[model samples]
Target: MVVHALHIRPSRPGAWLLGLLALLLMLPAKTPAVEGVEGELRGAHRWSGEVLLSGPVLLSEGASLEIAAGTRVRALAPESSLRVQGVLRVLGTAQAPVVFATPQGWHGLLFERPELPQILRHARFSGAAAAIHAQAAQLVLEAVVFEGCDLALKALREARLEIQGGRFEGNRVGVDLELKSFAEIRDVHFVDNAEAALLATGGCRLNISDCLFQGNGKALSLLQKISGTIHANRFVGNDGALVATRLGAGLDVSGNFFEGNRVALASNTFSQPLVVDNRFVKNETAIASDQFSTGEFRHNLFQGNQSALINTRRADPLVTRNVFERNQVAIFCDFASYPQVRENNFFGNQMAVKLGTYQSAAGARPPGAQREAQAGANGPGPAPTFAEERPLQDFVDVSANWWGADTDLLASLDEQGNSPIFFDRRDEAEVKSQDAFAAGGPIDWVRFRPWLIAPVADAGPR
Candidate 1:
């Protein structure tokens, strides 16, 4: 008759350990699958499972590699890689992220002389060829994610990156600043990169701000002497979003938003950028400026462009306070271009200005030549090396513009009786007042003086 005496104390023993920690926080959390690794990683390496790189994995040079948080690196291609010349510390944790995938395209993550300063937090590089390849190491990529790469990130020579909040998708050339690297691209998001999401050359030194270059094919391609500052970016539907060629000088492209491009901003040869307050919508040619390219197009905004500024070789731009709406041709000055067209605002353009005819313009390259053609006396270099052929030097100054009509109705419709808006030389001031710098010959045309009885109203949006 011995009854079972179960003595259970009913007193709070810290409430039964807080009810067993709320039943282990309502249990249902299991993440423990780490068993995958492949050879080679000398001296001080610390990994946390699932990392089958299956091939090239060198890291020796007083080595030191460390990857933890939810790691899952699988790179098994025709030539998998991990390179690194020593020291890589990734403790990713944006809810424990640290993936570096590959389906059959790997050869990425290759920092060269890294001894320190290599932190890639919350990383996620995919199918690579260059998901990350620094040369003279010193990286710091936070919240990163460069998908389907071919050149998602290629910082050559003197690398010193610092890309924060990255996300360069479907790459072909997302970020490939060559030679002298020094990036600092913030809040990045270069989508659909098929060519130039950012291809800065030789002397790279970008400082791109709040970026977002969508549908990229040429969202930025400053070559040669690249010195950047692409601020407030948003270059949409690319195809020619930004092209600054050769000597790509100190850019400062401010407040950008050049939409639907086919040629949003293109400079050539001596690319000297500074294009400010940009906003060229529906572009087909919102600024071309060829060959001896020069820039400083202030307060820009050329709507519905079909041609809102072409300027050929000798492209000396300075067109200030811009706003050339409804473009069919807002200003196409041919070669020998010396654009200083001030206070612009030519509305509803069906042809607000053309000035082509130095043999019908396009064939005037003499701003220091050099696109191959060096025999004796720089002969072949100036024969219209193709800046649309070059030849609009018929004087063009177009002062204090407003041009919707007024200036004796555009000099009584230039050609005296052809009145639909023309101009060979209206209210003349010839080459002596607008800080003349001559070269304008061939019967010099286009002077367009003190015009503007209205419509400038802050030079943009009509």
Candidate 2:
């Protein structure tokens, strides 16, 4: 109390405290809140149970929707989906791959929009009807494993699929192409499927390069009017390597190594396909065609096959410039169908060419006997002793120089040691004469005929 009516100011400490309280009142209150969208198990907010999403859950730019490794997602009944109408980029490493499996069978990722973007790598999807169904969208998947699914990648109706370095195993069908879709499958492995490893239907175009197809029921099957280019691929240990039917056109199969398959190329009637530049080793039949189907067999190497290089019922193929080596019987033309044989190397086979009663007796008759018989019947009136038909036109210009066990024939002639003996007929002996087919050297025996069989037979280029 001031007796003289004097009012005193507050202390400096009191003023400072009042000012600090006023500053605290002006500041906004802070609370603990969720940071990102729900259902993601990372960051502050983690969701459990089925995540029923009505709208697309977009992640932050440059951020990935990462499902933790060894984590399983169980979708709710009648609502089993994680539909991404936008982009769903999953980045999984080899050791820790993200899994999108359900408690029961369901759909994993349904990409609906045409412009939806998705990138899935090193991920696993199982127990789903379709692991990944991309419709009219662009999908880039690599190092992914798909199992227990009907179809691994169902790219439908103008969708594009570029799959590389992935494994599609234990699925009904590995990759199903439909309705003008385009797919480029490279560096992939497909095995142990009930149906075909890669099935292309609905006029699609599949370019399979540098891939391995092994232990599958049917490796690659093409139906409808689809066109496929299978190049630089290895098909081994499959039931059937390739089966194309129903008027499919523009199938360019080249530079692919086919080994140990049951049937290499099986084409039905009305399907004219091109099979060129492929190596067929130890296959049951390299090519088998039937009834009005035309096959172009060119620049392909056929070795160690059990049956004919080309076994056809009625199709007259355009066979040109192919090498047939060590096969059992090359070119078995059955049912009166004759392939147009031209410029092809027929050597090292058990039987180079077998006409199978298709060629006429006159055409099959031996060359030397025909001339002798005409002269004998016209003037001498005595028939020749040997009358056997030899293959002539079928082997237009076949060189036995590289024939099996005949490589020595060519070397002897080059050395100029001795004039090799060529037998005109099978019932001949080795005689030292210049007129024979030599083991190695070039000699025209048609002009000279000394001891007919001995000189021609023993004089082979050697």
Candidate 3:
């Protein structure tokens, strides 16, 4: 055997280059071929690298599709959609996320099959009809970014979706829930959606928590008996942060921070939601309700708002244990609203409460063509109530409230003796009860009595 000497070089540019070349030779080469997916998939298929959807794709029953990390799927046209009647699994790492890009517009991904579970994690979807549309499916999406879409995600027809740790921005709507859809959305950032961030209708149930709603038109919009819990969310710089209508009930809204909104909450048309432990700061109107909408408003902090609450058209909310500080108007009741205002602290507000009705005939019908046509100033007849009076439901009970210690200030609010009773301008001065009035009559009193001498403790969720 011939003896061979081993040569080693140290601290030289040419040696470093050679060492790098050797290391490159030891590494595996990356795959370059991009798979094109289209038409129908009936068997299990795996996709990786840059994928181009040549046409609409359908994953039929008993088929499974898996997308690997660092994959980019681009839609070719507006009508292209991925309809999965089977199962889809997108397995993407945090560093190498999967992207579904729509250069123009597309129909987006649609999922069927309620029993099959679908998982999408570390995915980015952009510019489609809706980024993901799930109908009666069980889907879980995590760390997904949806941007510039008509709607970010739509869940319909009794679907169960768990969306966690996502970002929704620059869309018409962030999430749309309809037809008894049940969703649990948490730790999402929704920003600058044009219409609403989260919209639920048609008896949907949603549990939204730990989310941030910023610069959207409406942060939350509920219609048609939507019920859920919304907690620990931040709503900032929206037009109307939360809006409910059409008999929405059984909602628990708590531990929210609202700031710089045109209206923080707007309830209409018999919607009754429980709102508690929320903090409102610098909003134009903290809460505005009309058309017989009523709710339990308790333990809320209203600070630096233009107006705290405005209840109109027989909207009789139960207001209790709230702190209203430095507001222009604490509460304004009009058009026969009968709020049960008790155990609240009103400090540094221009006016604690104003109770009256303004008669208007702008939208009124002809003089004698059925008084039902011109029932209330804001709308038609109130929703039938269980109370004694159907129209003027009850007295405006302003009792056991802290309005500072100055009796002189209380007198300036038109108080008499220990209890101040107000009369409607339309009614005779002698009448105290409005119980005998018709179904859509005006209210008669702002009974300000049995007041508290000291301020209530500042205790509520922040």
lDDT tens digits, residue span 318-406, model 3: 99889888888788876556678888887778766665543211111122323433454347666333333222223466878887644
lDDT of 2 by residue, 1-462 (tens): 222322335655477666666667666654332222324222222322223433224333333354444333444542446665545666667876766645445655767653655777787876567777777878888888887677777878778888888788878888877788888889999887668788777888888999988887888888777787888999898888888776546888888888988888777665778888788899988787766578677777888887545534456677766766778876655333456655555456765544343222222223354576667778856665442333322211223222334334434454223322221112121222332211211111111111111112221111
Predict model 2's lDDT versus the native: 0.62
lDDT of 1 by residue, 1-462 (tens): 233333445684666666666667667665554434455678897777566766777887778989998788776663767888888898888888988767646777788877688898988886677777888888998878888778778888888889888688888888877898889888888888898788878888888888888888888887888886888778888888888888556878888788888888888887888888878888889888877787688888888888888887567778877888788887876545777887777777777776555312223434444343343236734343334445444456676788764456665543424334443333222332221222333424665666777767777522
User: All models: lDDT?
Assistant: 0.74, 0.62, 0.79
Measured against the true structure, the TM-scores of the candidates, in listed sequence, are: 0.42, 0.63, 0.82
> In candidate 1, which residue pairs get closer than 3 Å at backbone N, Cα or C atoms, i.e. clash?
334-392, 335-391, 335-392, 361-391, 362-389, 362-390, 362-391, 363-389, 363-390, 394-445
* Model 2 stretches astray by more than 4 angstroms: 1-72, 76-79, 311-313, 354-462
TM-score of 1: 0.42
The ten-residue window of minimal lDDT in model 1 covers 429-438
Q: How accurate is candidate 3 locally (lDDT)?
A: 0.79
Clashes of each: 10, 34, 0
Q: What 10-residue stretch in candidate 2 is worst by lDDT?
A: 446-455
